[model samples]
Target chain A: MRKLKAVKITQAIVELVKRANFSLRKDVLFALRKAYGFEKNRRAKTILKAILDNAAYAQKENLAICQDTGMPVVFVQLGQDLKISGNLKAAINSGIESGYKKYSLRNSICKDPLLRGKSGFSPCIIHMDIVSGNKITLTLLPKGFGCENKSQLKMFKPTSSLEEIKSFIIDAVKSAGADACPPYVIGVGIGGSADYASLLAKKALLKKIKLQRGLSPKGTVPGLERELLFEINNLNIGPLGLGGRATALAVNIQTYPTHIAGLPVAVNISCHALRSAEIVL
Target chain B: MKRIYTPLDLNKIKSLKAGQEVFLSGTIYTARDQAHKRLVQAIKSRQTLPFELRDAVIYYCGPTQTPQGKVIGSCGPTTSSRMDAFSGFILAQGLRGMIGKGSRGLGVKEAIKKYKGIYFITYAGCGALLSKYVKSVKKVAYGDLGPEAILKLEVENFPLIVAIDVNGGSVYG
Candidate 1:
């Protein structure tokens, strides 16, 4: 068994949170650049240019990309053979407390659903997966509520057609309008249970944009990813929903085997400022 | 591009059309979900507002804490739809304009038309760039709300697009 100190995990979490909030992943930047080059509408081009410029300034100034600085979503890949010396949950929480303070990131977590109170970060969301390895991997995704509030989940009959799934995603995106901050990076999960499907869609969000921007998958739904991307952009929602081309940067999908009688699909949308970071220790 | 100043009068707002880009300068107040709710409640109780609402423009934003030596931190527009329920009441209080991004619900559009108000959309998620336009910021009320606290901001050459015009033209169309 490989022994890892809990403080090492805590330090890595702090760095990951700081880096994720301050700079966007390279895959997201590449997709935005590609969209900027191909966009034909004047207004869309202007919006895209400003977004890219903001990203540049945020990096140079060591500032956050946006003010939301959403709740930190940390994913931990713990090795089965690893032995942790300290309280893992406490270590993670301490990292969030210090990281939020040190970086001046907004603490958006509220104590209650309806009642508003004094501001502080409470209950940072963390997901853990046990994998076979000697190394521990941690990823931080600062998910803003604007796009998160717009996500949807629906359970369909097992006999449902692929076209039905496509339309469902389109409908969700259409209803989202500009509230989700298009052009979005759409994440879709298919064939799992309702909860599993939703979680799968969010996990799909961690996929590199390089794999989703224009690439399509084969088998049960051949080229469906590319097809959905084309149709959604054609909706003319555009950047900031001011109407133009380039409404979505990419569409990524993850699938799982479902029960014999049901098909569950989930759609999770992400804004252009796709912020995430990862580290291995 | 049109240049407009804050404390905007109805006539100045009426001259605007949807889909036109504009640079707004001068003073505007910032408020988001919690503050808006409080404002409406105060109005219902006939309590005096924190600031005079007549001809004032409110920007819906909750900025991050300012680091040392910076004028302000990253500040950008939040989604407009969440505040839709209170917009009519706020407009009735003599607000001439609002700054936010995304589609406004029908009620908000109706309030804009009935009161001859305008809506503006800054580049969403471009907080770093937007912060450069803000000359200064001061807390006006609701200090307990942290980022949601109401703030008075002085700005120059702040860029925005007219998403909804006083005459009811909508960019969503």
Candidate 2:
């Protein structure tokens, strides 16, 4: 068994947190910039421009791209052949605590939710996946409150159709309105138990920005992603839903086989400032 | 329709049109759930407010830390509806405007119409990208709330859109 160095993992995580807070992914940035060119609404164009400018300002000043630096969500992809030499959870949390403290990131975690009292450090929201390779992949997403507030999961009749799936996404966005932020990225998981659906939905947001083999180009991704994107954006929810044109930037869906009696779905919305990063060790 | 700033009066707010984009400027207040509740409670009890509430624009934000000697952290709008139940009383107390993201409750719309106030929506999740507009900041009250405290900030050309007008026109459902 290959020995894993706790020192390397911890150090990399701390750096990941800092880097993720200050930077938006290049692919996402390019998408936003391109969206500006395609968006015909004048207000939307200006809004997109402002979003681009904000990205620049965030980078130049070494500041979080959004005021809500969010809870440090960590995704660990471990190798089945390797060994983690130390307390993995503790090290990740330590990295989170140190990252927040070092970067002056806001401590958004609370004791019981209802804003009763403060929870000093954000607990690491971690998910571990064992893969066949010998490397460990760590990804960080500082999920802000706005997007998190709008996340939803529902179990439907096993016979539900595509329209019903559409309703769940629409309702989730309408209720979320400008709260979850607009020109958002929606992650949807269908056909799992509620929690599992939500888990997969969250994981969907961490996937590569490009369409892949999992969703066949012609029949799967472009078909569903564009169709849903068209409808959601046309909701006229627009930038901030103060009304314009661009509402949702994209919708990514992933489904799992589930019990025959029900169809479960979850939506995890990612706001315009989708700040996340990943690295393999 | 135009975006106005804090320390403003009802007259300026009333002049704003529905569905107009306003560029916010001047001083603004930071207050979330806790601070809002406290402000409303103080009003009922005839207690002194941390700051005066006349034609003032309250920003719904909880900023991050600025370790490198700065006035404030990443200050952006929180969910507006979270402060919905408390908005009526605050509006009746001569408040002119509220800035946040998302839809406000029906009560808030009614109150806005009754009191001739407006709700403004800023870009959500654009906090780090929006803090550049802050020229100065003053910690007024509720420091204990950590990021949820009441702060006074001076902004220039802060971006916003009028979501609910004095006439009760809602941009979002």
In DockQ terms, which candidate is top?
Answer: 1
Question: In every candidate, what fraction of the native interface contacts is reproduced?
Answer: 0.79, 0.79
Model 1, global lDDT: 0.88
**How many clashing residue pairs appear in each of the predictions shown?**
1, 7
- Candidate 2 pairs with clashing backbones: A65-B128, A66-B128, A183-A247, B1-B16, B1-B17, B2-B22, B3-B22
True-contact fraction for model 1?
0.79
**Deviation in Å, model 1, residue A226 alpha carbon:** 0.9
Worst 10 residues of 2 chain A by lDDT: A210-219
Candidate 1 deviant stretches above 4 angstroms: A211-222
* Pairs clashing within candidate 1: A183-A247
A1-281 per-residue lDDT for model 1 (tens digits) = 99999998889889987899888789999989999999999989999999999999988887789998987888889999999899887888788878877887787888776775887864678899999988889888889999999899999999998889899999999998987778899889997799989988888889987644344464344388788888999999989997777888888889999999999999988989888999988
DockQ of candidate 1 is 0.85
Give the candidate number with the greatest lDDT. Answer: 1
Fold similarity of candidate 1's chain A to the true chain A, as a TM-score: 0.96
lDDT of 2 at A74: 92
Regions more than 4 Å wrong, model 2: A211-222, B1-6
